[model samples]
Every structure is written in structure tokens, then in C-alpha cells.
Target: MQYDFDKIILRNGTNAIKWDGLDKTFGAADILPMWIADMDFEAPQPVIDAVVNRAQHGIYGYTEKPESFYSSISNWMKKRHGWQIDNKWIEVSAGVVPAISLSILSYSEPGDKILLQSPVYYPFFSAIESNNRVMVNNQLIYENHQYKIDFNDLESKLKTGVKVIILCNPHNPVGRVWSREELEKIGELCIRYNVIIVSDEIHSDLIFGKHTHIPIASISEELAERTVTCMAPSKTFNIAGLYTSAVIISDDTLRGEFKNTMNRLNAEAKNLFGIIALEAAYTYGEEWLEQALPYLEGNLDFLVDYFITKIPNIKVSKPQGTYLAWLDCKELGMNQKDLVDFFIHKA
Candidate 1:
């Protein structure tokens, strides 16, 4: 059950976007890819074995998700996060980013205002703007070397006919595992403003230290009814290429609309290997994750301490969850262009 997370794996020749496509993405092949969210470790052995076993059957066809797929998700949510969900609440998606677009299509119209916390995951910006929706920002406040939700700004934005707000629980880039109190405040505002919450909980499994990731919907039944929570085994198991994710919607009408969007987009068909890997990951990858978390935590600690000791000008925001870190390089006295050059050409 002990996973060797310290073992370095070569991903260069593989079609991994994080490694193989770096030259095309960053304009230099030599640049280290610390940008993409996918991890550098190998997936859980059980997941690999399950996919290999499935591939050995020697038939690739349109695959239907088995009952085990639904059960694995439902059970994993209940056991890991203490969030009880019915199998019926689960809907299929290839990825969380795509699911976000689907939710925007399902619940809001073109030109409808959608809110986001600034400095969030970049794709969130694209999901709203590309769909022709008005993008609104309620930027997070940075104080005392940490990030905090600007609840006042959030509430003010929500009041402006904002039809949807995409919340990043255990927020990306900034790395705040939202507390229950913060989630409740967001829930209360959404309820008051009649805005739907599309919560991206993809990083829920990778929390660190004393911080617990509370699924925003789990706080209250009222919150659950309006929240469309997107999650996947992809990030937890480093299977992002497999492209399997789930959208859990408790409200019957909301679920139906999301399903309708999926059907309209012809996106309900699950990937053959993705399904096998997902089921294996949720059912048997916990021990692998239990090991990976400590490794990740150790990595975070090293990064933070290294910055303090060696790279004094670059302050690191020690995350409460997820492997991603937010680095502040303002004290280095570089402009945006200089910073890009420093990381790409010098660092």
C-alpha cells in the first residue's frame, strides 16, 4: 500500500501536455513545466492494472458506464468527505472545465452575468467568456501573506443580476480551502441573490495539514439544492489524460437541465479506459492517495522553506490543499515581462 512518490518518472516522449507539449506551450523546450495542474507521479497500480486488464480484452467499442461507476463515486464521496449522495445525482462529463461550460449552458443564457473570484483557475474565465456570458470578478483579498474571500465584494457582485457564480472550493492558484463559515456566507449570498453555484471541487482530495475540504453543498440542504459540484478521479489519481469527471446535482430540475446539455452536446459517452480507471481509482486508490498526500505536503514544506532560506525575495503561499503553490515575486522588483523572462530564460 506504500506508494513510491519520490521515484522520478520520465514523461518527455509521452503525449503528456504537461511535459511533451511544453515547447509548443511555452516557446522553449528546456523550460521546466511547473505550470500544468497534472502531477508528475505515476497513477495508482490498481488503476493501471484495471485499464491494462480491460485493454487485454482486445476490443475497443463504445462503452457504457457500469453500475460500479455510480456506486464508486457515491461511496467515495460519503466515505472521504462525509457527503452522502445518491447514485442518481451523478452525471457524466469528460472533464471539469467542460462541465463548467455545460453548467453555464444549462442554467444561464448568453449575456447573463457570471461571477468568479479573481486569481482563480484560468479556465474558469474562458468557460464564462467563451460562452458569451458576461464575466464578473469578485477578487480575493491578500492580507497577512494569505488569501481571504472578499465577501463584501462577492455580495455586491452577486446583486447585479449575476445568474451564476463558479466557486473554486480549495481554490486554485491562491490555494484557500474555504472554511465552513466562508462557504455558508457564499451560500447565503447565492440564496439571497437567486444565483446558481457551480462549484469546482476537483482538488478536494489533495488537502494538507489541519485543513479539511468541506464540499460547499454539504453545509446546508438549501446550498445542495442550488450547487452543481464538479469532481473527478483524474486529479486525485493523476489520470487527467483519461478525462473522466462527474457533476453531482441534488436538485431534480438542475440535474435534468445538465443532462439535457450533455445530451445536446453528445458528451454523455464515457471513455473506455477512463471509466475503468475511474472505478479502480475511487474504489482502491485511497491507500495510494494517503501516501501521495504526505509526499505532496513534504514537497510543499520544502518549497516554502527553500524560498525563505534561499529565494528570499519570492514568498510562497503555503497551501492548505492541492499541490499547486502561489508564489509572490513582487519583492524581486520585476515587471510582468521581466518576470516571464526570468522564469523562462533565467530561472
Candidate 2:
């Protein structure tokens, strides 16, 4: 079955933030908004069917993540990334951001320093500071048209008594999938420093050609204990609105603490549709992903070539994973306001 990557689904009336909310967000309805993270294409038919089946039942009541939910997700992880996860390790959550906040709350204390690689997802900052924790940056080194971790700076910060290191594998904005060596180096540092690692692997499934997504915990049992891994089909299936994700913590103690935090927040129940959609996605969306990936690679290639030939000034980061691209506009040399205006008004 060939999937339609080029088919344009009308989302303008669907309250999609990427489309319908553009007027409210950017103050212009006609800017061809591309700032949001979701794709313009529809989710897989299996996912649609799952949600529709649940919807047709016509009873929206309290829902829970069944054992099958964990089994389905576990199977998907094993098959997709070769990471074996037990059902006990999976904690259902509304989304990755909430899971991060919960992990931050569970593992670290207020005013305690936590580390992040900067120019990351903006919510990471709020997840730390809003919880009254200090945000530390072990900034990534950007040179030769790619990004690399500054391990020395990371170690220096860890030595200063950082409690938790929030990691974004297949990093956002700058989308280089962290190499195994890089992951191990950071893991070793965290272990030595007795710091917890909250790795956000939300975009793990969307990896491009030749790049693999490695679950941090899968590196070793010890590292797994020290890590809180967040993942979801939200990004992969374009189901963010459904708000379901898994926080995989293989360590018994860490899993307990994170679950305790979720219980405290009263977030244990997932919506009926999200539960069905997640199961449907993991069980039957493999074929859809097989088709979608090549289309995504083509889109990325086109963007790269267009920028190089037509714009020549703006540089777009070539992502090894995820559909989102980071545009490097440093060469434009305009102030932030001017840059915003350039895209919103001029470009």
C-alpha cells in the first residue's frame, strides 16, 4: 500500500496550532507558518481507525493504560530500535514535557543545579526553572557545519554538583543524533558525578538514513538505573493533541519515584482515544513509517539544495533524525527583532 506523502489535508479549520492558530500566534494568517513541529500530512490509517473505533463507542470515561499498551510499546521499541524494554519499566504520561517536569521534580530538589545542552527545546528551560531548579548549560560546540558535545564543559558543570542532566537525543533545533561514544562519555560522567540523566528520546523514531536512535538506558544496566527515558508516538504519528507518552525508567527506584510524582500530580489516567491510538500506532503503523521516512529524506534534501542554490546566505542544519530543521541565520547579521521581521514580513 503506497501512502500519500504529497496529499495536502485541510487542517485550517481543525484548530491545529500549526495552521488555524497562526493568526493568533504570529499576528498574520498568511505567513505560511512552518514554526510548529507537527507535519502537514495525516497520521496512519491504523491510528485513525483506532481513534474512530473508540469514538464510535460513544462513552468518554476515565481510562487507564492497559498491560497490552505496555506490551505493544515494548514490542515496537524492540523491533524499531533494538532496545528491549519490560512493561514494568513503562510509565504512561500525557507528553514528553510533562514527563521531564515530573522527572525533574522527582529526582532533583529546588535550587539544585541541573544541566542542559543549550539551543535546545525551549520548554526544557521552563521545566527546570518553573520547578525552582537552577539551569546549567554545557553548551554544544558548533563548527564545520555540525554540532558536537563539549565534554569538558559538561564535566566541569557536573563537578560543580549538578543533580540531573536533561538530555535531548537526536537533539532538537540542531538535529545530530548523539553517537554511542558521545552518549557513553556523558553517561560515564553522570555516573561519576552521581547525577541523574533524564533523556528525552521523543524524536527517536524519526531518524534519517544511516543514523540510529539508541535508548540511553540500553547502553548498560547501571546507566539505565541513572536514566529516565521519555518517548512517544506523538511525533512519529503526528498525534501530539492526543497527549500520550511513555517514561521508561528501568531502575526500580527511579521508576517508583517518577511514578510517585505522577500520582502526586494526579496524572496517571490517559484518555481513551490516546490509549487506543498509541496501541494502534505501535502495532500497525510500521508500514506507514517505512513509506514516510523516504518522503521525509526527500523533503530534507530538497530544502538543503534550495537553500544552497537560491538563498545562499541562510544555512539549514542537516538533520540526521526528526522532521524539523534548524535554520542558521547568524550570517544574516540582523538583530533578533529584525530577524523575526525578515521571516514574518520580508522573507
Candidate 3:
């Protein structure tokens, strides 16, 4: 069945932050709100059906992650990425950001150094620092309109007694799906330095064209022992509001510590609707994704071509995965503040 990708749905007054809360968020209600990562499109029909069915039952009580939840996650991982994971490895969390913060709290002390690739998802900075951990930057190298890991800098930073390194697998803001070779180099360094890796693989399912997302833990047994992978149906199925995500930890010790943290913080309880939506999404959302991906690719193509013809100065760094397009606006001769104002106020 073909999904309607061209249909425009009115999200205003739906409590959607991207549409309804625009005035509060961006100081203008009329401005098109494209800041949040949430998709404008509705989630899969099956997901909607499941959520609505659950709501119709009337009692919204505390929910638990059932055996089927783990099965859905494990099966989806294997089917989509060729990564086979056991049910025990999956731990349900409220969201990816919360999982990251919990992992930071669980694995590292307040003064310990936590590493991140610079220009990553902004929340990562807060996740590390807000926990009183020092944030270290192993910046990515941008060359030829593509982003590459500065392995030398990464290794050097790791050597300085870093306790944890947060990795954005298909990096955000700059979307290069890290190749196996790149992941291997990173894995080797983490192993050598005894650094725990918290990999945010939230965008793992949104690959474009021939690009493949290799779960860093799926690389090797050694890597899996130290890696905590954060994944969710939220990004894939446009269900971010559900706040349901999974943190896959193969290591028993790490899993125990992370779960302990969750329990201590009273955050282990799963959202009822989120659980229903997640299971439905994982079980039946693939057809929707299959259609959505090509539509997104077409959108990307249009943006690239449009930039070439109309906005040549704002070069587009075409992504290998995810729907985000990174625009390089250095050629526009505007400083950061002016450029932001240009897009926010003047454009």
C-alpha cells in the first residue's frame, strides 16, 4: 500500500511544539517552525491504531515492558541491521536523551571526563556537563563538504583519562554515517583507554541510498562489552512525544549499573501508550518506512538542486542517512548571529 507523502496535515493547535508552540519557542507564531527534529508527517497507521485502541480501553495505568517488547526490538535490530541481540540486553527508557544522561550518571563520576565529537547534538553537551562531568571535544574534520573523524585527536583525548565517550553513530547536524572502518578505529581506542561508549543510534533506521548503519556494538564482542546503544522507534516512526526508547547493553555489569540508576531515579516505569506504540511500530511500521525513505530522498534531492540554482552560497552537505540537510553558510559573508537572524527574522 502506498502512503501519502505529499499530503499536508495541519498540526497547529495540536499542541505540537513545532507548530503550535512556535510563538513561545521562536518568538513568532507566523514563522515556519522547522527547528525540532520531529517529523511533520503522521506516524504509521498501525501505530495509530494500536495507540488509539489502548486509549479506548479507558484506564491509563502504569505499564511494563513486556516480553514482546524486547522481542520486537531484537527482531527489528536483526531484520533491519543484521544485528542479533538477546532480550536481556534491552532496557526500556523514557527517551534517548534521558538514557544518555542515565548512562552518564551510572558509568562515570562527576569529575571524570566525557568525550564527544564537537558540533554533535547539543543535548550531549548538557548530558555530560549537567551531571558535573567534564566535556572533552574530539572534533570532526570537515573536508570536501563531508565530515570525518579526527582519529588522532580522538585517541589523544581518550588517553587523557576519559571515562566515557558519547558517539552519534549517524552523526547529527552533520550527517555522515560512520563507516565500519571509522567505528573500528573508535572501538580500538575506547578499548585501549578503558572508556565506555554510549552510542546514540536513534537515527539508525533512516539510511539513504547505499549507505548502511553499522551498530558499533555489532562490530565485535569486545566492543559490545563496553558499548551502550540508545535506539528508539521515535525517530523512525515520528513518535518522539511517546518518549519510549531502548538502551541495549550486552555487558551484564553495565546493564546492572544503568538499570540501578534508572530505579534509583524512579524512571524505570514505562509509559503505557508508548509501549503500545513502540511494539506496533516495530512490528508493522516497516512498510511505512520503506515508502517514507524514498520520499525523504526525493526531498533531499529537491533541496540540493534548489540550493544549487537559487541559494548557491549556502552549500548543502548532502547526508548519507537521516532527513536532515546541513547547510554551510560561510560564503554568505554573514556572522553567526546575523546568519541566524537572516533565517529566523529576515528570511
Q: Better model by lDDT, 1 or 2?
A: 1
Report the C-alpha lDDT of model 3 over 16-132, residue by residue, as the tens digit. Answer: 888888789767888877788988888999999999998999999876678998999999999999999999999988899999999999999989999999788999999988999
| Model 2 whole-model lDDT (C-alpha atoms) | 0.91
RMSD of 1: 0.9
Badly placed stretches (over 4 Å) of model 2 are none
lDDT of 3 at 34: 71
Query: Local error of candidate 3 at 39, Å?
Result: 1.0
For each candidate, what TM-score against the reference? 0.98, 0.98, 0.98
Ranking by lDDT: 1, 3, 2
How many residue-pair clashes does candidate 2 contain? 0
Candidate 1, 154-232: lDDT as tens digits:
8888998999999998899888999999999999999999999999999999999899999998998999999999999
Off by more than 4 A, model 3:
none
- How many residue pairs clash (N, CA or C atoms closer than 3 angstroms) in each of the candidate models, in the order given? 0, 0, 0
Local error of candidate 3 at 79, Å? 0.1
Residue 157 in model 1: lDDT: 87
Cα misplacement distance, residue 186 of candidate 1 (Å): 0.3
